[model samples]
Target chain A: MKAVAVLPGKPNSVHLREIPQPKLNDQPHAHVCSIPEGRAVLVKTLQIGVDATDREINEALYGNAPPGGEHLVIGHESFGEVLEVGAKVTELKPGDLVSCTVRRPGGSIYDKIGRNDITSEETYYERGINLCHGYMTEMFVDDAEYMVKVPPQLRHLGVLSEPASVCAKAIDQAYLAQHRLQVWSPKRAFVLGAGQIGLLATMMLKLRGLDVYTLATKPGPHRKSEIATAYGATYVSTKQESMHDLAKRVGKP
Target chain B: MKAVAVLPGKPNSVHLREIPQPKLNDQPHAHVCSIPEGRAVLVKTLQIGVDATDREINEALYGNAPPGGEHLVIGHESFGEVLEVGAKVTELKPGDLVSCTVRRPGGSIYDKIGRNDITSEETYYERGINLCHGYMTEMFVDDAEYMVKVPPQLRHLGVLSEPASVCAKAIDQAYLAQHRLQVWSPKRAFVLGAGQIGLLATMMLKLRGLDVYTLATKPGPHRKSEIATAYGATYVSTKQESMHDLAKRVGKP
Candidate 1:
């Protein structure tokens, strides 16, 4: 299968190459075949979202990498469909649609079932980082728990789920969980940056209900900020007026 | 009273000088003047928390503050008693023990009752950031809403509240709110580092029921691992183990 490999862990380190078709065998620790055990599926990739953190990490590390490996398969956000299943596989089967984060699900069923700290207790299921393989390829395998069945409405959003979920969580953290939405909260919020993460943050914040505002540091009238506004923000400028005063005034409503 | 002031923005820009004592004056904001406010009482300071963020920002900006200079009078995160209040202030009275987060009730009563996001907004009320004040001083003011009555069990944990709350928030972010305990099962968690944040992450994960593990880049014993285990974690030397094998074992857990 074809995949992108990081040659030296640098910004320009990516090399597209063919590798041995993933052995779809069902090893005890890995599923070479989709039909391995309890609940898992194999997927053929349709799309994957590239992430900034990925770029940044690669650039920071430059070419230096951990000892044994000189090249690595890159990417995790993926959308695909099952082609087969094992006897124990239940939630998925041939041709079911799916998308999931880089994280995988592992450990005893009991541990998964009982943990109170899912993030901490989560099996180290990163596909692209700190793990054996990832799904930038034509095919891959994933546990059912890592899979999110894309509803028909959201099917268009396929592999975008990883980021959308992240945005959702950030919104939950910054507003909903913090009780930011109350009787008379600010009708507007202005995200100062116009980068990808900032845009995503703005998107989620808007979803939680703020007249979202995005600040364009340089102007081409950033589309990201516009999208943020369309979602709900009221874009602001650092040079226009004091955001502090605006926050005080607009926040009153 | 003595206060550190920044005259300009620079690494070497700080001056510890004596400033006029800030006495209770007729300020439009809430005050604890030992007067009758319905349920709230104003308190004098008993303890204040030191914030590292404050120190850096101060050194960076020579105290050439933006508008709303009054907010800089004192830092947040302190325990104090209600000294005085308007006849309307209630819920706290003088001598009631309380430890407060830097959470500002907000910019105004209109904002508060209206649930305006302004006063409480991170952009508006972020303590120690923006032009907002830090939490190191002889005295400061707080509202009943921003105040959390310290539990008897946590009485001795006074100044630790700020850091503990931060740790609590991170763990909660990583696990609790995101269904860390409910979904995304894990067999083992390898906390990549053994710093304060990492240690706290370990502890929180343990509390949530993960076989917590730690990997430190530096030389050290598993003191953090021990605390994590006490809090609930398994231990491992990240450098000593093969990450792929570790992931395989834990990913399938």
Candidate 2:
């Protein structure tokens, strides 16, 4: 199989190379192979989203090649189709679309509790971002537990799952803090950036009935601002108004 | 009333001074007084927890005096008794024990959504920490919405609420991330420090049925270590075992 890879410690050395395909395995911990033990699913890659992390990896800013491997596969945000299922897998079948999560569990209690994202040990691996192969290749396999099933109606939007998860996590924390108030009702939201993360967050906040406002450095009438308006968010140009001034104008909710 | 305050830009220049007491108000946004419209509460200070934030403020590392004030009051973690309530305040009454939340809402959508903690705008205020009077005074008033009722049984533990709230926020985020998994269960927690924040986290994780381990540089049988053990958590001395080696021994949960 041909895969996109970056040579470790070699900045801007991304290249396409032929790599050996993964094998099927019975052990749950096997990284490159489908788990034959009924808990893993073999996935054929369909789409991969390239984001800042991939650019940073290519720049040698951060990212690690697998142990003893000179090059690392480079892509994490991914959507794929399940090609095979382990004997015990019951929730999914071949041809099901799925999106694989980036961060893998580490040897921490956080991982045990399904929180590899906040693993306290600082030793967790992110697919394509560090010490692990990602889903930029023709095919890959992951434990079924780590894959989010994509609804057929939204399969085309599956590549967005990873970034959307980030927005979900942020909103979840905000709500947790708001729980301190007895009659809490968030009415307005200000998103600081107009990038994918900010736009996605704006959409989520708008869906929750909050008046959403997004600030970006770009001029008005741009595509990003258009998208924000399309999502019912008011877009502001930071070049014209300082955050402090804008915040003061907004007043307290 | 006599209050402790720090002169900004002058490290360790904390001193006692007589300050004017707050008054009742009808506007909900007034900081130091009860809302006269029956939606606020007047609180008399009962206990205050002095922690690292106070030390930093004293050292002039961070913290701001309220607008037009030369010195900032120096306390945020507080337990108080409600002395009065506005007409609209139904959740709290006179003589009830309460611990006030530190951060106040800013004029942003996050504040509207009850998420002043993660306010996207930097204009948010933390009582006694920045641009607001802290709870070090003899008496204060706040909107009833910001106070957390401290049960009579836990009044003695009330001062710990602020620090415990930090741990609560962290665990809440961790659990939110873990929700990505279908059968998430965190079995162990490793807290890196034995300071107030870490100790509180250790206690919270232990309560959640996880085998908690806290690492500190201090030798065994110390007070902090004893507290961890009392909470059913194991204390490890980092002086003896390297973190990498310890993590390897613990392995992935």
Candidate 3:
């Protein structure tokens, strides 16, 4: 199988390389093939989203290859299909659409309870990011624990599940933080950037009944600002007017 | 009556000053006496705890006097006895032990919902610390909404309530933050400072079944160290060993 990979610590070293097809127990590394194991899943890649993290990794800003391996696979936002499932895998079956979680568990107690995403350990692992193989290849095998089944009707949008999860988690955190208040009915929300994540967050907050304000450095009536305004969000150009002045005009978020 | 006051923005200007006795509706300013209002209470000052906030205010670091006033009354941590209650004040009555909440409501929506402590507005009001007068005087009047009833038996420790509330709120925030984890059973707790708040937090965490480490600059066997050790927490002298070495020696916290 040919897969996109980058030599860790080498800038612009992204290239396709041949690797052995994955097997059920060949979970961590494809070349280290082993006999099939129950509850393991073999997935055929469908779509992978290239994000800022991937660009930085390719730029050699930060990324670690798997131990004893020279190259790191660089796609973390992924959607795939279940080509095969171990006998003990009851939740997902062959032909099921799926998206795998990015971060893999580390040795922290947080990892022991399914909260590996918030692991306290200094050294952590994330698929396709730090010391782990990501889902940028033709196929990969992982424990069923990391795969989230996506419905067939939503297959086209499944590629967005990873990024959407990031937005969802951020919204969850906002509500959790504001839980300190006796009653918090925020009528307005201010999102500071106009990137993909920011736009997604603006839509989410708008859906939640907040009057949204999306601020960006770029002056606009451009597509991004158009999308924001289409969703009833006020888009402000920080380059044209300072955030302080904008806030003074729009009121508190 | 004599009360401690500071000329706002004037360093070392703390001095005793005479102010008129407080009456119901004499809320925002001591001299602006008005007719009593419903839900108001007159509290006779019992004890006031002076902390770092007072020192900073005295040093002209930050503080505000009421509008059209020159001197700011400098005390926030206070315990008092209810000397009188407004006609419509139902929860509290004369002779009840009480402590006043520090921050009062501002214009932001957060303040409107009784969460003034986290008001989003750039301008805020806090009793004794900002535009409002504090409880350092012989007596003061406030809405019953701001007065928390302290049981008669706990009167001796009432002054500690303000500081204890600060620690309590911090722990609540920590739990709120860690709620992202599926399960977070932090086995070890590390407290960076051994100040009054730090010691209080150390004791609280110790009581909550965590193995706590209280780190301070001074060498151990002192009173603060003794208090920490008495609470079943290990006291580490950071001067003796760097935090990096200490963490490596003990374990993750």
Candidate 4:
């Protein structure tokens, strides 16, 4: 199997390398291979999205190889085709399209609750970013619990689920905060830094019926601002107005 | 007015000092005091809660003195009574019991959207914890928007709101992360450390109908464990089982 990997702590060392293909019913840690592990699926690679985290890992800003390994596989945002499944796997089967979550569970109780993303302890691991092989290979195996199913209508968009999940998490958090005050009905939102995350957040907020405003360094009538406006969001370029002035104009929430 | 303050970068220098009281119509930076700042409210201190952040500030672990000032007031969690309001203040009134939020808005758009708690930039200010004066003083003024009203029934419990808010934020974040799967109904929660935050989290989780378990270093048959049991939550002493074992027993969400 071919995989994209980076030499840990070595900047600009990203390359394609041959790795052993994963085997079904192979339990590296288990004493007996015959023991059935429920909900474990092996996925064949389809698409991998490159984002800022990948760039950082390539730059050796922050990434770690799996224990005893010198290189780390480098892709967390990915779409894949399910090629194999363990005996007890029921949610997914061969030919199913899916997207795998980036961060894997650590030893924390929050991790046990499938909420490792909010684990206060810093022991959590993200695929490709640190201490684990990611889905940037020809194929990978992960617990079916961590994979989200992609519908046939949205197969191409599955690779985008990882980044979109970030926005979803942010909006969910905002609503949770607002839940403190039961009367709060958010009418407006301001998203800074019109990057992928920002634009996705703008789209999410627009979908929620909020008048969205996005601030970015790119001077508009640029494509980014146009996309924001197309989503019924107002776009502002920092070059024209200072953040302080824009915040004042938007006023308090 | 007398307030407890600490000189930044100097450990164990906490002392009481008399600072000038805030004026109703004084605008320190504005060219005119009558510029009609409507949201700012003047609060009279009633109660202040001491937490680890205060200890950190006292030990010079992390805290900043206000700019142009020699020391920073050291209390972020507090309950107070509204003393005065600007022309536009509407949510609160004079003599109203309230709890003022510790963190103040920064230049980020997150701050503008009333979500400064999740502000991405590190420029945000914490009352008494950083560059802003905290609520340990006799009286302090803040924007009416930052104050959470305390009902008469919960007046005595109002001081607990700050610590409770931390737990609230954590649970909110956990739910946000869990929101990825639509059918996720958490059946159990394990709170580690059994401190103020942990206990409060246990209570919140119990309120949400989960079987809550608390892990603490203290031996069982103690007051903390009794409180846990009183809340209908199970208490586990770390002396009996390690965190790793406990997490495995709880299973995955």
Instruction: State the lDDT of candidate 1 residue by residue for B13-41, as single tens digits.
Output: 45565655444342223321121234343
Residues A1-253, candidate 2: write the lDDT tens digits. 9899999789999999998776445332345333336687888999999989899999999898877779889898999999988788899999999999988777666676777786676655778888787778988877888889999999989999999999988887677655544345778899999988999999999999999989999779999999999999999999988889889998866
Q: Give the Cα error of residue B129 in candidate 1, in Å.
A: 21
State which candidate, 1 or 4, has the greater TM-score.
4
User: Which of the predicted structures, 3 or 4, would earn the higher DockQ when compared with the native?
Assistant: 3
- For chain B alone, what TM-score does every candidate structure achieve against the true structure? 0.65, 0.93, 0.93, 0.91
- TM-scores of all candidate predictions against the true structure: 0.50, 0.58, 0.82, 0.53
Using alpha carbons, what is the TM-score of model 2?
0.58
Top candidate on TM-score is 3
- Model 1 agreement with the true structure over A126-225: per-residue lDDT tens digits: 5665344566777776556567777666677777777767666655545444342333344656677766667777877766666666776454446764
Give DockQ per model, in order. 0.08, 0.08, 0.43, 0.05
Model 3 DockQ class: acceptable
Q: Write the number of the candidate with greater TM-score, choosing between 1 and 3.
A: 3
Question: For candidate 4, lDDT tens digit of each residue in B99-137?
Answer: 988776665657667777876565557877877778899
* lDDT for position A58 in model 4: 93
Tell me how many clashing residue pairs each candidate has.
68, 13, 1, 0
Q: Write the per-residue lDDT of candidate 3 for residues A1-253, one digit (tens) a residue.
A: 9789999899999999888898776657433222246979999999999989999999999899988889998899889999998898999999999999988766677777777777788876788888888889999888888899999999988998998889988888778766656556778889999887888899999999999999999999899999999989999999998989987887654
lDDT of candidates 1 onward, in order: 0.57, 0.83, 0.86, 0.82
Q: How is the predicted docking of candidate 2 categorized under the CAPRI scheme?
A: incorrect
* TM match of model 4 to true structure: 0.53
